[model samples]
Target: MKTLVNTLMMRVIEYFASKDMSQITHTLCVHEYTRLIALREGYKTRKVLLLELAALLHDIGCPRSKELYGNCLPVNQERIGAEIVSEWMPAYGKLAPKEIDWLVKVVGTHHQLPMAKEYGFEALFEADLIVNLMEGYYPKEKAALYEKNMVRTASGKALFELFFHHGKMDIKSD
Candidate 1:
């Protein structure tokens, strides 16, 4: 079952392979990081699967935005990506409509409008932040601020501290 889930997710990701190679790699990185963070935080099978899928498709609109506007604007990508996910989910993952909607919401809002206390959201947000940090896509100076303000889950906070803050601060599990 797990293999089936993962394979389908990978196929969905590869569906856009011709768009932008870097974006695909970025999604893959986010997917792996999301998986790691979710496991570390003791997320169960269903939640982990959802988070991973969200991570994989979080920026699915990047290529479209780049092609249209020559840049990846967050708002544009979010809107476009949600539409893309809506069409792809049913065909690729066999996800129910509600689950597909949930995935779309998480992927669309991950950048600017995340609500508090949501484990899947926090995991995907933190995973993308960590990858963006390492890839130099985002400014390092702002990571500390975002970590302080945005990260909610213990594992997410711990990973942020370890990567951006060098593990100087002690991490406690909730």
Candidate 2:
């Protein structure tokens, strides 16, 4: 199951595999941060799996958007990337339809702020927060302004506070 998931996600990101090494590295860090935050928060294994998808494909549409729109805004990329992910993920046979529903939404709108206080969406949001904070793209995207706006589960909130207080993105210096 894990291999299947990785295979599907790799194919999705392969769309941008040649564009920028930084893009790939940035994504890997996001994924790692997602796992750390999820485990640190004590999220269920299944939920952590969903968050993994969110991080891996978070910027998957950037290359396509650069070709068509000359810009790779997070919102647009996530929208298109979700469309692509929809093609392969449903066949994986792990998550229920409802889980898939939340997973799809999480991937699609990961860039934008939460529109509702929903669990899946908040999970993706908080995970992205950790990534942005680590990547030093926090305040630039106005994400730093949201560090205090915690949501999601108790574990998630704790992890968010850890990152929030650290203020540094917890990434490597060199």
Candidate 3:
């Protein structure tokens, strides 16, 4: 299952191979970090894999958004990515419509607050923030505190705290 997921993810990367490679790297890191956090929380293996898939393709709409409007705003990006992923439902095999819906929503709003109570989206969102904090993209103090409080699962919090204090990425001085 894990190998299948990685293969799927790599295929996604290749499909978008003409796009910004950094975003793909960032997406994978977010998925990986989120998986680490979710695993510690005892989330089912299936759920964790779903979240990883969601994380990897969440930004899938960015290139379109960039070409159309020069931005990757949460709503716009998610909607676009969702539509794209939805088209793949036939090839994806066995995924229910609801699952696709959730994937769309997760990919769409990762930049905004988590709108669902389900821990899956929240975990994915927090993991992305963890990576962003490392990138020095979010304001340090707030990002630090967000890292501290927003995590819902045991592993989520632990991974966040580690990145909060020791992440390798630093803010580039403007």
Which prediction has more favorable lDDT, 1 or 3?
A: 1
Clashes of each: 0, 1, 1
C-alpha TM-scores of all predictions: 0.86, 0.72, 0.84
Error of 1 at 73 (Å): 0.7
- Model 3: which ten-residue window has the lowest total lDDT? 165-174
lDDT (10s digit) by residue, model 3, range 7-100: 7788778866787777877878887887766666667888888887887887888888888889977677878887887776447675677877
Candidate that would win on lDDT: 1
* Clashing pairs in model 3, backbone N/Cα/C closer than 3 A: 78-108
Using TM-score as the measure, what is the rank order of every candidate, best first?
Answer: 1, 3, 2
Q: Write the per-residue lDDT of candidate 2 for residues 43-157, one digit (tens) a residue.
A: 7877788778767777776777777788878767777777766765687777678776766676677766654255454555666666666688756344435654555555445
- Runs of candidate 1 with Cα error greater than 4 angstroms are 116-120, 168-174
True lDDT of residue 94, candidate 3: 56
Q: How close is candidate 3 to the true structure, as a TM-score?
A: 0.84
